[model samples]
Target: MGFLDISHVTKSYGQVQVLHEVDIAVQEGEFLVLVGPSGCGKSTLLNMIAGLEAISSGDIAIKGRVINGVHPSKRNIAMVFQSYALYPNMTVGQNMTFGLEMHGVPKPARDAALADVAKLLQIDHLLDRKPGQLSGGQRQRVAMGRALVRNPDVFLFDEPLSNLDAKLRVDMRTEIKKLHQKLKTTIVYVTHDQIEAMTLSTRIAVMNKGYVQQLGTPKEIYDTPANLFVATFMGSPAMNILPATVVMEGGQPHAEITDADGARRLLRFSQGNLAEWADKPILLGIRPEAITDPEGADRKSANIQPLANRVTVTEPAGSDTFVTMTLSGKDVIARMRADAMVAPGEVFDFAINMDKAVAFDPATEARIPQ
Candidate 1:
């Protein structure tokens, strides 16, 4: 059995529903990330699992036992919220031991727990200091330390790193991943940040409008998204969805797209099991990394179909560069190596790696075979 099972879980407030018949099975020691945009009910689902919010319908089971009616304190689960939720008046030591104290744990046992957690989190020196004196990252660690001290069955993180700055957030994300590896604990994390989800999760559930759009590993979600929403939401520069028509060329599927000069190009997809979608009205989804400048020697093997287009803008972000160009009357972003020597208003020959391209049906918004 799965470590935690959310069976047809639903949540509603008064007359409105926030979570709709969601089901997720979390394996032991697995890091599962629930990710989506604001108002998508990711946090609501996490809260329900933590017992902070009641489930409007369905059942939640941990280790094959129903926990639907269990009180938060008796659930054997620990939560780390975005706000840190540290007590201003208490020292870090006291904050970490508070839950144990309430549970009637002996003083000697509680002290040992605090010592172990402090050492694990690398915050032993700050145990005597109050939350007010610690930096944002330090305080976040203390909050996590508090949860770690509990030695609970599962850990629920509700955007725990959201309050930190970008650099600190990245640092803390690495710390959390290392911590989880050491502890081998089951974790369910909720966040709207796609980068966090992609980097930290063993599996990710892409949520939208109170429903799960797709659940898969990061590579599966990135390379083969289940639908258009997932295709657009998972990538950094976002997948470029171009309107195209599919036609059969020698019994194979080829996507026809109009380039900037009103010239038509047929990009063939001969990947595994793509013969089903021979001819259809589909949207071509391509990541920025899949498109490259043809003149670059590194992309010699990348099916260079030279498309003439004037670059509208160029953004250099250290390791890579992004160029914006108009294709089929829609703007498309291309990511290339930082050394790519292309300037604005320059017409360049671009090549797309059609082997990695994806196709989605226009009507159902679902991925097609080709």
Candidate 2:
């Protein structure tokens, strides 16, 4: 039996459906991330699992027991909300122990739990201070510490790191991962940030418009997205999707892309199970890294073709430079080495890693090969 099972769970507020028969199974100690844009029902799903929101239909089970109708406190789950939700007047230590105090836990046990969690979160010295006295990151750690004190069957995080600044968010992301590793607890985390989902999740459920678009490991979701929504949503620079038509050239399939300058290019993919997409309009999906400068040693062994395009915009961020160009009448960004020198309006040649490109049906938006 799965440790946490949300079986065909659905929720609606009046006539507006927020979650459409969402289903997810989390293994024991698995870190599952539910990620999507705001109002996509990721947090609603998390709330349902936390028992904060009532399920419109279907069931939720934890540790092989149904908890659909259980109260929030009785579900043996700890939830850390985005707002921190800390007691304003209480010190950090008191906030961390408030739940245990209400549960009638002895002072010794509460103190021990506070000491252990404070040390684990590196907030031991700040325990005597109130939430107002700490930084955003420190308050987040206190919120997490409050959750950790319970050692509940499941931990629900509703964008717990969203309140922090970028640098602190990254730091807390690492802290959460380390805490998960040390505690070996089942965690269901909700967030709108794709990078957070990619970095922290054992499996990610990409939600959109009250439905789950895809659920898979970070690599799987990035390399082989379920549909157009997922492909466009999960990546940082976003996957470069261009409208193209599939044509059979010399008994093989090829994606023909027409550049903004009216120049035409043919990209050939491996032919095996793509016979059905012949002579049809399709969307070609390619990551920015796949189309890069061909100076690397790995480019020699790869089947890539050089395409020349004039750069419209160049953004350098120390490590890599992002160059944007017009391709197939759409803006496409490519990541190149920062040392590579190319200015705006200057044409540069890049090799497209055609083997990594994916094709999607234009009408249905599903992957073509599968």
C-alpha lDDT (0 to 100) for residue 129 of candidate 1: 100
Q: Per-residue alpha-carbon lDDT of model 1 for 1-370, expressed as tens digits?
A: 5899999999999999989999899999999999999999999999999998999999999999899999999999999989999989999999999999999999999999999999988999999999999999999999999999999999999999989999999999999999988889999999999999999999999999999999999999889999999999998999999998777778766888877677887887756355566555789998998888875434434444456678999999999999999888899999988989889999987777886788898999999854
Per-candidate local distance difference test: 0.90, 0.89
Model 2 scores a C-alpha lDDT of 0.89
TM-score for each of the candidates = 0.95, 0.96
lDDT of 2 at 165: 88
Q: List runs of model 2 lying over 4 Å from the truth.
A: 297-301
lDDT of 1 at 54: 95
Q: How many residue pairs in model 1 have overlapping backbones?
A: 0
Q: How well is each residue in 212-308 modelled by candidate 2, as lDDT tens digits?
A: 9999999999988999999999887999999987877887788889877788888877644565777778899988878777773145444686788
Best by TM-score: 2
